[model samples]
Target: MIAYDLMKRLKELGYIKEERDPYWWPKSGSFEVVVGAVLTQNTKWENVEKALENLKNELGSIEPQKIVEMDQKRLAALIKPAGFYNTKAFRIQKLVHNMLDEYGSFEAFQKRPSRSWLLAQKGIGFETADSILNYACYKDFLVVDAYTARILNFLGYELQTYQEIQEFLSDSILENLDRIYELYGQEMPLSQIYARFHGKIVEFCKEHCKGRDQAEKIKELLV
Candidate 1:
């Protein structure tokens, strides 16, 4: 199999998510994905969950407007479990404040977040921006993270940039969807395919595929 074919190989190895979840992401299109996407940077998802629970309990619902109007110190306190809470709270505030001033609602913001809009914000990076675009708005941007880069390296391609890997994997996977359907016997929407592709890559790396020899474990399923 080619380096970018790892996602398809993973599915053949029984790694793709089978559930067509109603709430595909934790809280699809909700403020939670936005908050989690920001808080998750440099932190574990477990920590993000703890911080999210704190926010949910405090605000009764995760609303961008509520966050925009929140006191920075208090917001930081609620997200303290995620660590770097002070900075993260300010970052979320920056994003929410922008949403409020320009778009006026998450719905509006999600509808028209031009490619560089989120990236031009205070704290959004490539992965975080793509996370929000893909998970929050269900946009068709592919998410690439450390696990993706690491696994690809193990497959003998050492990419140096996030956009490079993201575009490469996305183009490769979408171009190979026919092969994927043939192998898995099902067709998935592009959003779900990208979402699950990222999810499965993270899961596979966390579960049985790790170390510098990550590719070795899945060699049998290679195309």
Candidate 2:
């Protein structure tokens, strides 16, 4: 099936039916997403949550300026639950410093995002950068993670790289904008569509794409 068809199926299965906190990422446009994006690398969301809670408890907030002023060692200890604490702390600090220097604040950066600048950061790769853009900046960039690749591969697509997978799914949805509106009964923004689509994939995979019976489970759902 095509990406649109899969998205329709996932929606029908009751994913993203209502507004929720941490729907895909923490409330969109929050600075916590920026920090969570980095902390989430090579770790589970639960671990990321622990680290975020630690930060919120310690600093009472997770602002970029606060992170910039905080000591790296202390920051590392707070985020240690997410793993690679030392490296992630450094990267997070560097990102916040550069972002503040360039955009002055998280609100300003959200107003005018720069994908190239995000990618140029030390630990911000394509996925991490795209997460910040899509979730934090509310951009129309679809995030392709391992779940996306696995689901597509199970659907008989031979996409080999991140770009190919992202392009295929994005183009499919873009080309069928009218159908999407009909499906949802409203003209949703592309950013929201991409966000919900990624959320559906992650949720679906978590529920039905585990263990040796993964392929069978996916086939049953698609069928």
Candidate 3:
């Protein structure tokens, strides 16, 4: 399907209003994107933003070494707003330190690897790993997000697990990587696209899909 057609359907379903969510911030680096993915689980982006800002102020930087070297307690404090601060801090520290110890530097870690290797990291689920690879490393990947899930589920598609969605989308775009890249490029990199896409879905769920009645109607459209 054409990208415009998909966009139109999403807009008509009240999933992608042009005016309500106009901002997009593309990701800059792999480590930074991974940090975000870890911090974002079950939390508001606004809170994540606050925590990230605090981390920057306290650590003097967001580079892997800094994150690895930060005091666990203090680091947890800085990222408290992101929730589950203790676990997140350890996760972030381990990820950063692992990258440094294994690869020696951020540039080394940027090297592309077999998909199996990516799947092996702790807290590195398909989405988080793909976000890091596609956004931070500029690899061609079709990111299946919460919005994608809601829209697909509404269409009577039941992705039993995240892997199922990943595999389906991966297969759908397998022969069309270039086209996928172009469509995704319109939202490019991953950060801005992710922020806008996530924000749009969250807003739509809050406004239109809050109850069973609305949700059922929305799901009917998918059929």
Candidate 1 per-residue C-alpha lDDT over 36-60 given as tens digits, one digit per residue, 9 for 90 to 100: 9999999987899899999989999
Off by over 4 Å in 3: 2-4, 11-26, 113-115, 171-207, 216-223
| lDDT (Cα, 0-100) at 196 in candidate 1 | 78
Worst 10 residues of 2 by lDDT: 16-25
Return model 1's CA RMSD, one decimal. Answer: 2.5
Candidate number with the higher TM-score (2 or 3) = 2
lDDT of each: 0.80, 0.89, 0.64
What are the per-residue Cα lDDT tens digits for candidate 2 across 1-223? 2878998999888886445654366667798899999999999988999999999999998888799999999999999999999999999999999999999999999988999999999988889999999999889999999999999878778999989999999999999999998998999889988888998898888777887647756967974
RMSD for all candidates, in order, please: 2.5, 1.7, 4.5
Query: Whole-model lDDT for model 1 versus the true structure?
Result: 0.80
Residue pairs in clash, model 2: none
Candidate 3 to truth, TM: 0.74
Q: Which of the predicted structures, 1 or 3, would earn the higher TM-score when compared with the native?
A: 1
Better of 1 and 3 by lDDT: 1
Collision pairs in model 1:
none
